[model samples]
Target: MDYSFTTIGALIGMAVAIILIIKKVQPAYSLILGALIGGVIGSGNLILTVDTMVSGAQSMISSVLRIMTSGILAGTLIKTGAAEKIAEVIVQKLGEKRALIAVAAATMVICAVGVFVDISVITVAPIALAIGKKAGYNKASLLLAMIGGGKAGNIISPNPNTIAVSEAFQVDLTSLMIKNIIPAVCALIVTVIIATILSKKAGTMVSDQDLEKHADNKKLPTFIQAFAGPLTVIILLALRPIFSIVIDPLIALPLGGLVCAIACGSLVQFREFAEFGLSKVAGVSILLIGTGTIAGIIKASALQYDVISLLEMMKMPAFILAPIAGILMAGATASTTAGSTIASQTFAQTLLNAGIPAISAGAMIHAGSTVIDSLPHGSFFHATGGSVGMNIKERMKLIPFEACIGLTSTIVAVIVYLI
Candidate 1:
């Protein structure tokens, strides 16, 4: 892919941003500065650069709103016992013989219902540690189970990544999710397989000393109560596509939070829980704005067409190219949402111009972002790794497992969307 000065300059800007992120600079700041740098070198117009950044940020408003609204649902599940109940019930029903699959299923379902992958991993952590201790699975394998499931469910989730791609491609969110299901399920299956194979090794469980134990005095919500909220949210969101009901995610997501509380008889706690969820929204919104600047710079510089020309020269079709772009961007950032954001921003139009449908293109790129998204630099790696008590080496050992799981899903999407 030979690039003109502008294309190369734009890439340099993105690289600078990635470098800043690696140096622990806040992503939003890194992105804005990077966009400015790219504008100067690529387009050589300071005024245009600022305008591009604003335009980019403005483009993200719809996705940001949807993402913020999701916080209530995510927060509700996290603070309430609903998330635990969902995990517990799934693991219990699957039984010990299928322990790896059970853990993967629990984590998958939790994230699929709109929770963030990091939160999903952390929520499943204590449970995963407990399962490892009881089942004598390796701590690495247990960590693998939780994180893998998080990646699996994330593609179809109503979380930031899903929202960003859906909006970018100008497709219905539910339609994107429907397109993502096969990929998500394929990733889940890969998680089970990899974790089970890893379970065969002689290894330590999560350190018993640091493991959080459940109090026998704790009263868990009934399974029915646990299912009530997610089911309600799912039903409501589905009405739009299934029956043309026009309930927005802003309404559907928070409503599900309240339903979860009511079903669990925790209406008294709803205020604090919803507040907890909304509190996290501002930070995410800021990160997304930063994401937009990068997308904006790339768009303004016409980086997408440069990429498309390169792919054409290589004789690659746009379907594979979109997923590859997602993988590289996500791997560079070590974050799914950021990766998907950039991929959709830079490549969505390219894919569309190449004759791929919006829904199909969005699904492939979203799923691809999950590929290698938990590389060591990303928070998902550190946060989930810390929760399961894995050291750097132990965590590093599982990168292959993560990549395999992610690639499996990407492959599924490529096949499904390659029409």
Candidate 2:
């Protein structure tokens, strides 16, 4: 590939941003500085840089503002004890004798329907701990199962990662879901098996007295009421094809939250939930704004074309190159959505050039990026670890195991797509 000063400069800026993020700089600030560096060095026009950044942020807001609805729904679910209720019902149905499997299954279901993993962890941790202790299962094993199952579901679900990929690559959402189902199920099975093995080895016993103390005392919503929000979102999204209903996730999520709120409590409760949800939106919005600016700068510089050319010259097979690109980008960014967006933008044409189908390529990218996104530095890792009461040292051991399982899942997806 031919070297251009602008392309080299853009690459350096991205590297710098990643380094800063790894060093614990706030992502929004690091990404903003990175965008400025790329824009100034690449185009040498400060006015254009500022315009692009503003326009990009505006565009991202229009596209992604609905993320707030999911946040609101998450908050409401946690505060109302709906999420715990959902876990309770699942565990009850699965029976306490198989608590490990029950926790994995429940988490998989919750995440597959678009609940955020961190929110799910916070909501389910108390119940999971109690269940594990009661069943004489290892706490670490149960936590890993919850994390792994949720990760597996998120990879294939119609969540942010898939939505970003769909927008970036122009892939069909329904087709993506259909293609991903088998791989997702396989991944979940793998997670359960791994957790079961670990539980057996740990072999920690729990006292009935201890289980009694940890028993839930919160006034939980009914099963139907508790699940109303998430179920509504899932059903609407699924029916979009048959009904041609175009249920925007932003609208669907908030509507679901409303349903749950009204079913379980009053408008007053919902107002508080909305406020908490908006607060959740604030942090993510800043990160997206920065990422959007970087995307705009990359586009302005036509850096994606150079990236495609460079990959073409490498002559790597799609099956091998796709996952490697995914894991590296996702690992660095600590975001599956960001990784998918970058890969889809940078390599869509490259995959086509290699005779790879877009659907398969998208799946491979999703799998690879998702696997390593929960690294120690990732917000999800911190949030999940904190929710489960695991200190940094304890989490350090568990996180790698979870990441390895995610990597294995990604490889399974790659192989499935190839076949």
TM-score of each: 0.96, 0.87
Clashing pairs in 1: none
The alpha-carbon RMSD values of the candidates against the true structure, listed in the order shown, are: 2.1, 3.3
lDDT of 2 by residue, 23-116 (tens): 8899878877887887788778788887876765665664366666667776677677777788889988998888877887777777666566
Where does model 1 exceed 4 Å of error? Answer: 1-5, 213-217
Relative to the true structure, candidate 1 reaches a TM of 0.96
10 residues in a row with least lDDT, candidate 2:
202-211
- RMSD over all Cα atoms, model 1: 2.1
State each model's CA lDDT, in order. 0.84, 0.72
lDDT (Cα, 0-100) at 295 in candidate 2: 65
Q: What does the lDDT read for residue 7 in candidate 2? A: 76
Which whole-number lDDT from 0 to 100 does residue 98 have in model 2?
80
